[model samples]
Target: MSKIVLYWHPMSSATPIACALAELGVPHERVKVDIHAGEQRKPAYLALNPNGKVPTLTVDGAPMFEALAIHLWLAGQYGVERGLWPAEGTPERLQAMAWSTWSYVTYGAQLVRLQTARDMGTPDDPHGQAGHKAMDELLALLDQRLASQPWMLGANYSMVDLIVGSVIGYSAYIGAPVQKHPHVLAWLGKVQARPAMQIDA
Candidate 1:
């Protein structure tokens, strides 16, 4: 098998990491961890990623976790430019990283929390409602931003698109609508149309 093995679960955020790898043409074996079955809680997964999160990749024997970090490393190492990043040190690069951070740290957290509450049968939770509000505000902010730039970092489809696009997919899965942002809808349609954009576990 290839040295890189990606431990993932379909029910998690591993989808974006997979999309990034597919964008880069990096072939890795998918180690399915039954998250619902508590597979990720097993000792094996904990050894790889103490956090027990999906998208933990063992690249050439080195373990790397977190979807965005893995994608950034892959983009740099493989020279795969799906418009996910720009040249380092340039204005474009700066903007791309900013948007990428916004997607993961800001928007992604809110969406994940909302989904977690609903998945654990806490759909009507007060915190979940707050998370939904955060999500809506984030989407509105994103929509306003997209009103100008074609992509998150100017008119290019860098890692920003992959990251944000994946978040949009998650929100949709949790009953959050993406139709409100016309630009996002158009951009997401393009991202999802990628042949390598597989929803692999």
Candidate 2:
């Protein structure tokens, strides 16, 4: 077994990575970086991740950063063996990669705009309205996909579901009006019900 250490902070983007680790049931070490205290910006942490973000993983002393990249790598390395990742060179694998990327790249982009607008207390502004519109379109796409299948990659649950679901769930948490999409709400409920998805806030 590789020596895996996860550097994380509470209630951040790192939460999803922690959830993934739990689902995989991998034995690893957890190091909390107190972003509130600026620990993430310290030189020691920056050496491992110049981005100076939480949720950096060290596998046998080699560091990897970025929440999405870490999730993909973990799914490939640990999740494949645990039946939480699709096999390599398969259509399901391709779909997994695509949907996972869409969750972050396509959906996450609009979500950020919405969040920024909300943080600035101008959620009713044109920028916020645009973000909401884009998000609704994206949610409709997700709803259509879930209407045909139980999970993201079909019948069985996988890391793709976790990855996509987490992003959508975060949007809903931040007031994205996700309840309007029934199919998406239902699918997200199922994903969230997993024991491994539970985390301390």
Go through the candidates in order and give each one's C-alpha lDDT: 0.77, 0.92
The true-versus-predicted C-alpha distance at residue 18 of model 2, in Å, is 0.4
Please give the lDDT score at residue 136 for candidate 2. 94
- What does candidate 1's lDDT look like per residue over 52-138, in tens digits? 878798988789888888876776666334445576768876776777778878888888778888998997699788888888778
CA deviation > 4 Å runs, candidate 1? 79-84, 120-125
Q: TM-scores across all candidates? A: 0.85, 0.97
Which prediction has the highest lDDT against the true structure?
Answer: 2
Clashes of each: 5, 0
Provide C-alpha RMSD values for all models, in order.
2.6, 0.9
Candidate 2 per-residue C-alpha lDDT over 1-201 given as tens digits, one digit per residue, 9 for 90 to 100: 999999999899899999998989988899999999999999999999999988899999999999999999999998887888988998989999999999999999999999999999999899999999999999999999998999998889999999999999999998887899898999999999999898662
Candidate 2 accuracy as TM-score:
0.97
Query: Which ranges of candidate 2 are over 4 A from the true structure?
Result: none
